[model samples]
Target: MLYKRGKTWWVDFVDASGQRVRRSAGTTDKAAAQELHDQLKAEAWRQSRLKESPARTWDEAALRWLDEKAYKASLKDDMQQLEWLHSFLSGMKLPDQDCRASPCL
Candidate 1:
């Protein structure tokens, strides 16, 4: 379902895991909002029924790494390195290519 919160449209629905998911559609247009809502619902269904996982980005992996390694002695250094790397790899999807082979590096 889609509803407006202020001027932006938001989506609310139940996933295949029976969990309620709600998030902004990130659009002011109702048509765009509905499209995003449908996509989200379809992705959730695929994840549950076909055991498929959504594509993850480098930023997501970096954040998860930071969370898991919060206690590491080199965490500060790691964060600085990640910050620097973010400029070149901010939105690159995970497992797509070798970071070392990236032309940006």
Candidate 2:
């Protein structure tokens, strides 16, 4: 995801089910963006596995995880984070099952 106003970082990806998802890691640093990218890829993989393995949808699990968190983030940060996620998830394709490459790799 391109930062809407600059001075921010975002990422997008496409999940296994072909849904676009975005996430914001909230840093302009290249290293940080890379880290978030890896995390988001992992998330997509995990979600995809859940779909194939008799588990809940990513949304369901995400909401549950959010509900379990004891602390709340600032609204501004939350929105930014969401943007980043959407950007990272938007253009991704599910990896071939026989391929050795991991999503983050």
Candidate 3:
């Protein structure tokens, strides 16, 4: 369900775990709010039933890669590569990144 708090629309729903989630939909439009609410509810269901984790960002993956490859002799080279990639991929979700459009690819 959606309700207006001032000008912004907020969503309220119960997840698969029976936890009540209340958050701003971040939009003033009713239709957009409804769509956001549906997406959030669906994501919660998928996470609970399919054991799916939330999408990871490029920075998280880069850090994990560095951690796992810390013992490698070429760790310095890996760090430099990651530093270059960071300017292009920072804050982007892994699945959302388009390799085809990237010059690095």
Candidate 4:
């Protein structure tokens, strides 16, 4: 969650269910705060994988890439492109696209 502590802005991890757990290493600069954000995301992901698969589909990978790069100057336009791309590919077969497959029973 994003919070302001004194003169610094922090984006640390708060447990979704627990609501009281906090993982914060205070940072006074934007770059450091961002680095901490990445570290927290990584840690959360690692923890989550213990309960479920870490494997992701192509669609999820694309979405993750978009999220990671969304702070860039081209973010708005990139989002537009993503919307268009998703729409265009909605019902199309993507056998070569490296997506998750459902095996025949």
lDDT of 2 by residue, 1-105 (tens): 434227777777776778887767688786788787777777778768765443344355445555665377665576566567756654454443433554454
Q: What TM-score would you give candidate 3 relative to the actual structure?
A: 0.61
Error of 4 at 48 (Å): 1.6
lDDT of 4 by residue, 1-53 (tens): 55667877667565433434354447678777777777666656665655533
Q: What is the lDDT of residue 66 in candidate 2?
A: 58
- Which scores better on TM-score, 3 or 4? 3
Return the TM-score for candidate 2, rounded to 2 decimals: 0.42
By TM-score, the candidates rank as 1, 3, 2, 4
TM-score winner between 2 and 3, please give it.
3
Residues 1-105 of candidate 3: C-alpha lDDT, one tens digit per residue: 999999999999999999899999999999999999999999999988898887889999999998888999999988999999999999998774457888543
After aligning candidate 2 to the native by TM-score, how far in Å is the CA of 61 from where it should be?
11
How much lDDT does each candidate structure score? 0.92, 0.62, 0.92, 0.63
Q: Between candidates 3 and 4, name the one with more favorable lDDT.
A: 3
Model 4: residues >4 Å from true position, as ranges? 14-23, 51-105
